[model samples]
Each structure stands twice: as C-alpha cells, then as structure tokens.
Target: MGDTFEAVKEVIVEVMKIDGKDLSMETRFIEDLQADSMDQFFLIDGFCEKFDINISDEDARKIKNVKDAVEFIDKAKA
Candidate 1:
C-alpha cells in the first residue's frame, strides 16, 4: 500500500503538473491541487495505466483525494 500510494502520488503530480513536495494523503484534487475535470480524467487514466485497473465513473467520483485513491486502489487490487 505504501508503494501504491507513492505511485499514485507520482501519477497525480504528473497529471496535475504540481510539485511532488506539495502532495500529501489529505490533498484534495480539486480543492488543494486545483484540478479540473480534465485533470481528474487524466489522473484516473494515469492510475489505471499504473495499476492496471479500470476505475468506473461512479467509483472515480468517490476518490476526491490521494488517500481515497490509494485506498480504492488497494481494495481493487485485493
């Protein structure tokens, strides 16, 4: 889960065009990171590519922050 969190963090940083130093588990994609809809889309795409899992739109909506994403991915992988 730690590795997955780091990987997700990397993907988020890449997609959001933000510095890795600015990231944290509680960082909200929209509120903290200033991510728009397209940024969200790309972030999901990055996650899917990295984890080899498909994230549904409904499921994606529940993932509002880095912690949410890592937890969701951990469950999916399990």
Candidate 2:
C-alpha cells in the first residue's frame, strides 16, 4: 500500500469505528464498513482535507473499496 492507502486505512477505521483487523483493501464500504452515504460524504471530506487534495462528488461516488479510494486520490495527484 502507498502512503495514501495507509492513511486511508487509518481514517476509515477511526471514522467508521471499524476494527482494523477486519478491514482489507477488498472490503466494500457499504457491505463491509456498513457505512451510509452520509458516512461516505464525511469520509470524502476528511480524506481530501487530510491529503490536501480535492475529491469531486462524482469521483467520491465511484469509490467502493479502500483500494479504490486510494487509487482515485493517487491518480488525481498524478
């Protein structure tokens, strides 16, 4: 995982109140994280702030897994 990926993991666990040991790159936000759209919104906001980047609503909607979110931010920066 990249730095962004690691940061995302920490944020997800902290914000979503999930067990770190239960989370993996493949874990689905809705299915595994049991997060609602509101949670997703907060996550996007927090992620962008933490990473000093911007994430559009459309881009945020495309996120499903941890890896997906990390890749989105990584690609945006690139």
Candidate 3:
C-alpha cells in the first residue's frame, strides 16, 4: 500500500476510534466502522484539514471505503 493509504487509514482509525489492525481498503465506513452521517462529515472534514484539500459534499458522499478516501486524497494531492 501507499503512504497516502496509511495516512488515510490513520485518519479513519483516529476519527472512528478503531483498531488499526482491523482496518483495510475494503472496510466500509458506514457498514464496518458503524459511522453515521455526522461521523462521515467529520471524517471528510478531517481529511480536508489533514491533506489541505477540500472535498465537495457530492464527492464526499461517493467515498464509501478506505480505498476511496486514499484514492481521493492521492488524486487531490497530485
């Protein structure tokens, strides 16, 4: 995996208060992480703050898993 992915994982783990060992690209934020809409908003906000990139509401809604967030940040960073 990429450093971007690791960073994204860190953000998710910190925000969701979950074990890092249990996280993966395929892990769904709502289904697996039990995150609600507010949690999702916080997650997107955290990502933007950490990466210095803004994510639109529509775009944020499309991000469903760790892989999506990592890819989004990677592209935004690029």
Candidate 4:
C-alpha cells in the first residue's frame, strides 16, 4: 500500500499541482485539494496511465480519497 500510495500521490500532485507533503490517505480530492470535475477526470486518467489499469467511470466515482485510490490500485494489481 505504501508504494501504491506514493504512486497515487505522485499523480495527484502532478494533476492537482499541489505539494505532496500535504497529501495523506484521508485527503479528499474535491474538498481538501479543491479539484474540479475536470481535475478529477485527469487524476483518474493519470492513475490509469501510471498503474496501467483500466478504471471505469463507475469505479472512478467511488474513489473519493487518497486511501481509496491506493486501495483500488492495490486490489486491481492483485
């Protein structure tokens, strides 16, 4: 999960253009990071590219926080 978290953090920091130091498992994309709908799409795309996994819109909607992203990727890889 640590590695997945780091990878997810990298994508969020890049897409959201924010400091990685402030990110955590509980960080919310919309509320905490101030990400808009487009930002959320790009974030999901970035994650797909980074992890080489296909995330459907249905699944993407369920990932509301850093922990969710990390856990999703970990499970997808498994």
Stronger candidate by lDDT (1 vs 4): 4
Candidate 3 per-residue lDDT over residues 1-78, each given as its tens digit: 479888888888889888889888899999999999989998999899989999999999999999999989989888
RMSD values, in order shown: 0.7, 1.2, 1.0, 0.5
lDDT by residue (20-66, candidate 2, tens digit) is 87667798898887899888988888789878899888888889889
lDDT of 1 by residue, 1-78 (tens): 889989998898788777888788899999998899999999999999999999999999999999999999999999
Q: What is the TM-score of each candidate against the true structure?
A: 0.96, 0.89, 0.94, 0.98
- lDDT (Cα, 0-100) at 42 in candidate 4: 99
- lDDT-sorted candidate list, best first: 4, 1, 3, 2
Candidates' C-alpha lDDT: 0.92, 0.84, 0.90, 0.96
Backbone clashes under 3 angstroms, per model: 0, 0, 0, 0
- Give the per-residue Cα lDDT of candidate 2 at 16: 90
Give the lowest summed-lDDT range of ten residues in model 4: 13-22
On a 0 to 100 scale, what is the lDDT of residue 67 in model 3?
90
- In model 2, the runs with Cα more than 4 Å from the true position are none
Candidate 2: count of backbone clashes, pairs at least 3 residues apart or interchain: 0
Worst 10 residues of 3 by lDDT: 1-10
